[model samples]
Structures are given as structure tokens and as C-alpha cells.
Target: MNSLSRMLEVLNLFKPEQPVIDIEVICSQLGYTSASAYRYVKELSNAGLLVRLPRGYALGPRIIELDRHMTQFDPLLAASRDIVGDLIAQTHLELLISELYDSTVINILQRSGADEQALNFGRGRPMDLFRSATAKVILAYLLPRQLKRLFDNAAPGDLERIGLTWKDFSKAMLRIRKDGYCISEGELDPGKSGIAAPIFDEKGRILGSITLAGNSERFNAFNREFLSTLMIDAARKITSRIAG
Candidate 1:
């Protein structure tokens, strides 16, 4: 990795489980010498990306500030805010707006009714690559080359979850694109089901997806066709808003 990449990698090391990291841990995990690790930490601290604590270094307040900016200014979130609220009022189900960041699908916004089950997927969390309706709908609109690259790197289990072979995977994605939406049940979370439709940019490039999720029993009991149509219409509205 280049120097800039190495420097940025330090930020990736912080996770929910390991929120604080010391210099020794950084050196051990990143294979950097004590001197280089300290230098990186110092620079990151100076930039307000890391805050030094008595125990270790924790993520700094800059991340929170950036999150606030994204909440207020992200075009996708801004476009979908009212639309998502409307969907929640209509369906009384959990709703998510997710975007593909490189190869990762991240849920950027969520809304849920009071009686809804606690969802494993939440705002700012990464969704499953193959199992989530949110991710699947977005993936269906990806370029063939991009799909192939992800397929080549996928684990055997992940491949099997979608299909047994490359052709099968390709067919599944094609079907979703043709249908303009995806439905998944008990894939990412047991007893949870979702329907998702893709949103697009002005150029018609896929930007993200909007999904509605609920308890599988309740989801199946509802008029799925009606729900699906609602989700598709909502997604199109968000896309148009983005373009406008």
C-alpha cells in the first residue's frame, strides 16, 4: 500500500468491538515499526481523526461531525427523507436506504414503526452482500464487469447462497433487473423479510436502494404485490428527486 493508504488504514482498525487501539496494537496489526506507527498516530491525532486516551487512541469527534454533515447534506438521504417517512406511514414497517460504497453496501438511513422487531441491520451498518434485498437490488444494476469481479472474489458459501454457478448468479441478477426489484426472506435475518427497489442517478446509473422490511409472518400475510408496487414507486420518486 502507498503511504496515504497505510495512514488511512489506521482508521479502519477501529470497530465496535475494538473501539480503542494503542500504538503497540497498531504496530502488531499493521506490521509497522514502532517509529512509523507512532508517526501515523501523531499525524492522525493532529488531523482530529484520532484522540489519544489514557488507555489507547479512540476515534475522534471528527467522525461525529462528518456524520452530522452527511445526515444533513447527503443527496440520497435528503431526497428520500420525506418519501421514506411516507412509506413508513403507509406500510408501518421498517425501512432502509442503502448505498453501495465500492463493493460494500451500507445502510445510510432507516425508519421503523414502534411495534417492529429490532433489526440486525441499522443505519451506517454494512448489509450482507448476497442475502439482503437492499444489497441485491443495487447489485442487480451493477455493470457486468463489476458483478464478475465480486463473483470471482466471493466465498463458496456466499456463491451458493445466491446460486450454484456463475451462470446461475448472472441469471438471478438479470431477473431482478428485469423485475425492477428484489424480495428476500430469512436471508440476512431469520424471520425477517424485505422488498427493495433500485434508485438511480441522473445518468440512470444505479445509486442505491430503498427497502421495506418486517417480520416474515406479517410480511407474507400482507398484500405483497401491492407492497412491491409501492416500493417501486417510492424508489422512482427518490431517483427523480435526485435527478431534479
Candidate 2:
């Protein structure tokens, strides 16, 4: 990879859940020897994309700036807007399309197609995993260490209360990551339901997630199995279009 791409690649190693990584982990991603990984780490640190901790490198502020620039013109919005509009025309349910950001999702764009209250997450609304299907699905696929940090940060003692032990959470995340999708019921809001799946780029990195969501009654009126299938297919279609 070129310098810019390589820098971005290294930055990609830091997830919202796992913001810090050791030299070994970086080496594992690149399959490089310690020396090579160290060299790149040094270069990335010099460029301020990486902040070296004792055991791992945390993402620095530079990456946050880069992220702002990329999502300013989100492809998911540009490419999927019309398609999402058409889907809503047929389905009647609103769309809450979003891309995963650090431990959250910023709804870059959305389409409601319905004349009723238009539903679109604004440009900078910070959404969390607790109340968003897209956020949960993205969280399910996030790096384990990063997820742990989130869980710990959000609710330390509550994990056991919710039957969400670290081990159980890990197992669930593994399954979700394997399935590449999630169906959430009241995971975010009391009456809100959603189905979501990942969108990927050419290198198989998750670009973001797209979700189909509506009032519980409207969603319950439809065949969830079919809707889930459609959403998953749509995710693949979007990914393929971008990757192509």
C-alpha cells in the first residue's frame, strides 16, 4: 500500500471498542515481522495517527479528523438514497441508515418516503448501541477489546445483571460477527424494532450499516423473516456496488 493507504490501514486497526493494540496485533493484521510492524508503528505515531500506550497504540486525534472528512459525503447515502427511497415506497417503513463511528453511529443520511413525520438522523446526532439496531449490529461486529471497553464504560456492574457476562457477550459477538447481521427487539427503544446488516468495501472492512426500522406496530404487521432477508440482501447489494 502507498503511504496514505498504509496510514489509513493502520488507523483502521483501532476500533471504537478496541482503541489500543499492541505491536503483535498490528503485526498480525499485516502479517509482518516485529521489525516491520515497529517501523510502521513508528511512522504512524510520528504522523499522529497513533498514540502509543504501554501495551498498545490507541487511535490519535488525527484519525478522528479523517473520519469527519470521509463521512461528510457518505457513499451509503449517495448510492443507497434512491434505492432506500424505493424500498420505503414499497415497504412503507422508514429508514435509519448509519455508519459506525467510535462506539456510536452518526446517521449521515436517511429516507422516509412517507409524508408522515419524516425520520432522518441529523448530521451529528450521536447514537448509542443501547437504542439503535444499526448501532447494536455494528457493536456485535466490533473488535472484542473495544466492545469490552464500551460495556465497561457504559455499565460496569450491570453486565451481570443483564446476564451479559464478558464471556457471554464475547460468545454473542462471535455469533453475530459470524452471521454478519443482527435483529434487535427493544434493544434500543421501548417500542422500536429494527433489522440491520453490514456494508463492506473492497477489502472486506465494514464501511457501515443500513437499517430498516419503524413503529413496532408497522414492523409487526410485516413478515420479519422476509424483512430480515431483504435487509441482508440489500446490505450485500450495497457492498457489492461499492466494491465493484
Candidate 3:
């Protein structure tokens, strides 16, 4: 791979589950020679994208700087912060704002309900797009060709887990588009359910998804119509704010 591509590959190796990675691990994971792996890590560390730790390397302060900039200025998150809090207060459910980045669904921010501590959704963590209402709602808005490409690239087990074969998956995407929102049960987290709506830009391009999640029992107790309405409304408001 090219130097830039190799650097990005090194950065991508750090996951929420494994925040620190050394040259040895990178060499093993990427099947790179020791010298090549060290060169990639050294470049990233020099650029402030990765930091040297006693044990290995972690994401550097540059990431935090970028995150602070996004949290402060990202139209979607800034516009929807109060609205997400309002949704949590009104529905007594945890809320999250997620963005689709390079086909991965990333949790950007979260608002807690009464059981704040119990709501363990990790902020900035990448989630499988096929596994949650939050991500699926965004997927519902992708162009047909893009959707097909993603589906074609997916593993059979992932397709089956989402309960869709190729033919069925297309039809289900259509239904999600028609419904304007998605309801997922025990998909992302067992025993937890969520409802999500897509946020769009002025051009009707999908921006991301806003979701309200809670215990399945709590979701069942609340009015489904009300929850869906709230989720969609929040999404629209965020879209509008960004448009202006």
C-alpha cells in the first residue's frame, strides 16, 4: 500500500476494544514486516495522530482536538443536543445521535434518561450498520446502487442475522423508506429496543440518524406512535437547523 494508505490502516487498527496498539501487533494484524510497521507507526506518531505510550501507541491528542471541534461546530450534533435532551425527558428513554462515516455508524453523542448509568452506549464507538435501528435508518436513505453494493459485500451470516436475503433485503429497505423510521428489537443490545429516524440535508441527502433506546418493557409501555413521532420530529428539526 501507499504511505498515506498504510498510515490510515495503522490508525484504523485501534478499536474501542483495543485502544492501544504496538508495532508488533500492527505487523501481525497487517502482515507487515517489522521495519515497515515501525515506519507507519512512526509517521502517525510524528503527525500527532497516534501517541507513544509505555506499552504501545494510543490515539493522540489530535483526535481529541478534532472531536472537540466537531462537538462544538458540527451542525447536526450542535443543533440536536437540546432536542435530544428533550426527547429523553419526554419519553424517559436514552437518546443517541449517530453519523454514517465510511459505511460505519458512529455514536457521536448521547443523552441519558432516568437510568443513566444503565444506558451504556459508548460515545464515538463504531457500531455495525446492519445491527441497529440507528444505523439501519441511515441505510434506508442510501442510493439504491450504494445499498446494493453494501449488501453484495456483506457476509451471508450478517445478511441472515438482519433477517433478509438479497431479494428480501431490497424489499425491506423499501419498507423502511416508506415508513420514514425503523424499529429494532434486541438487535444492537439484547433486551433493549430502539426507534430511529433519518436526518436529511437541504438537498434531501441523508445526514445521519437520531435514536431513542430503552428497555423493551419500557418501550412497550410507551405509545409507539408517540415515540416514532418524537424521533422523526427531532430528526427534521436537526435537518432544518443545518439547512439554515
lDDT of 3 at 14: 76
In the range 1-244, model 2's lDDT, one tens digit per residue, is 6756664676667666777888888778867678867888888888878887887888777878876776566566666766687678778777767777766787766666443644444444667764556776777766667877877776644354233677777776677677767776665555666778888777877678887776677777888778877888888888888887
Give the lDDT of residue 181 in candidate 1: 91
Better of 1 and 2 by lDDT: 1
lDDT (Cα, 0-100) at 55 in candidate 2: 75
The 10-residue segment of model 2 with minimum total lDDT is 155-164
Off by over 4 Å in 2: 1-73, 113-123, 156-163, 187-189
Which pairs of residues collide in candidate 3? Answer: none
TM-score of each: 0.95, 0.62, 0.89
Candidate ranking (lDDT, best to worst): 1, 3, 2
Candidate 1 Cα misplacement greater than 4 A, ranges: none
Per-residue lDDT of candidate 1, residues 22-130 (tens digit): 9899998989989989999999999889999999999998889999999999999999888888888887889999998888899999888544466788898886577
